[model samples]
Target chain A: MQIIIDPYSWLLGLAGGLLIGLSAALLLIGSGRIAGISGIAGNLLFERGPDRGWRALFVLGLILAPLIVGWLRPELRAAAPTVNAGMIVVAGLLVGFGTRLGSGCTSGHGICGISRLSPRSLLATATFMAAGFVTVYLIRHLPGLA
Target chain B: MKNLIGLLAGLLFGAGLTIGGMVQPQKVLGFLDLAGVWDPSLAFVMGGGLLVAFPAFALARRRDRPLFDLAFQIPTRNDIDKRLIVGAVLFGVGWGIAGYCPGPAIAALSALHPATLLFCVAMVAGMWLQRRLMR
Candidate 1:
């Protein structure tokens, strides 16, 4: 098995991760909220209350960040999708539904929850990660799938 | 004040994903494809995030309350229920298939890619579906 190592990508990922951590920290310090994208977005749609304002604004900021960055640094922007529309849709639905059912996603559970040393989050992260590894193995390595 | 902080946090989070290449489907897929030629960039992203967030959360434990709120609104649930396992597995399958999780998918909307738009729309619909099912 050959491993592909890219120092540039790793550095960029670390830098970006720092930014993500900083954002989470800021949200916690300032608003006493976890920076869980799934929770924020899901609640923004389903919940009706004073909480909507912050959720909406947070999503707006998320949407706007890439736009602003794309404008200024087009090369550094995210790439387009490689998968077909059908797969994207199906995956999106599953992610949305599953995250809500589980009460968290990578951000909520993997980042924030783990940081807080929550047992549930640790188990959830492990479960999802194992599931991901197995799923990818099936999709890519199985005889008929790939 | 809280709303403003939320916005800033979102912005930073999005930027992090984009800069880290986590917003790219291929990169995520590469990380997941452990049997194949594995890319370990995602690990660094998580590591870097945890390095900072761990300390911040520790500090938070010492504080009585946040700056803009009466109290911290952290989750306190600790049950290892069926829903958690089932939901995570399903989410993992979807993530493996499309290489887009909630955060990156939402941030990728700026690209205005048809697949991303469709994914986001479907994801919201899925969220709505879950709420309906729960009700």
Candidate 2:
């Protein structure tokens, strides 16, 4: 349960953000798609046939890259955070629902949406941020959940 | 060529999440817990992201067409509609409860957090449900 304090964490964050923005920009630039997770995941799940290969690969890369990094750098590995299976499931379901209802997730609205200066995305991102703020308040302050 | 760029971008993003300590839910929780013993580190993380992104976006805007091609696909809607408000509230609730948003949640897998797997599963299910109900 020891958290390693490393200066590299900042560099990583910056680099990651750039990658996300760049990827999003590239996706918009190259392909005519928004790099939204809900849209991508939805297409992967429901859409039929060969066209899904890239989406699958995009997701697969998302899963596999971490393992590769962990293999290369042992120090990068840290104790996994604790949470129960039920909580994780519930949280996921909520996120799924929210993403759908909102028509995008953070990547779509927060990253892509904000970048494009879409008023809807700006509103959506603001809403997402506000929701995150409230959720943190309830979890930390409310008696039962903590 | 485009797909390759997208893939590389995703890999860099995934790596960034791992290196940034963003893959850890606790770190995110700490960032969100503003009133308590909060970790202000995420602010720096966000600030760092904005530092790069703000300028990059500004530069992108100046161009008539993006480097790859075409104008940026900006969404046109602006209404503070019910769907927008309700969806945001739900998203916030999930985030508050779990401390893992979609991007970070997917990225957290590199850290190999078991919770992320569950989160992903549920996230897919949520998408499914929305498709069923709304459509």
- Which candidate's TM-score is highest? 1
lDDT of each residue in B39-64, candidate 1, tens digit only:
99999889989988999999999999
- Every candidate's fraction of true contacts kept comes to 0.80, 0.48
Misplaced by over 4 Å in model 1 are none
TM accuracy, model 2: 0.83
Q: What is the C-alpha lDDT of each candidate?
A: 0.89, 0.68
Off by over 4 Å in 2: A1-11, A48-51, A78-81, B52-74, B110-113
Q: For residues B1-135, what per-residue lDDT tens digits would candidate 2 score against the true structure?
A: 545655765675566555556667787777677666666556555555455555566666676665564556545677768887688778777876787777667766655556677788888888888889988
lDDT comparing candidate 2 with the true structure = 0.68
Task: For each candidate, give the TM-score of chain B.
Answer: 0.97, 0.87
Model 1 chain B scores worst on lDDT over the 10 consecutive residues at B17-26
What DockQ does candidate 1 have relative to the true complex?
0.83
RMSD of each: 1.1, 3.7
> Clashes in each model (backbone N, CA, C under 3 Å)?
0, 3
What's the TM-score of each model vs. the native? Answer: 0.97, 0.83
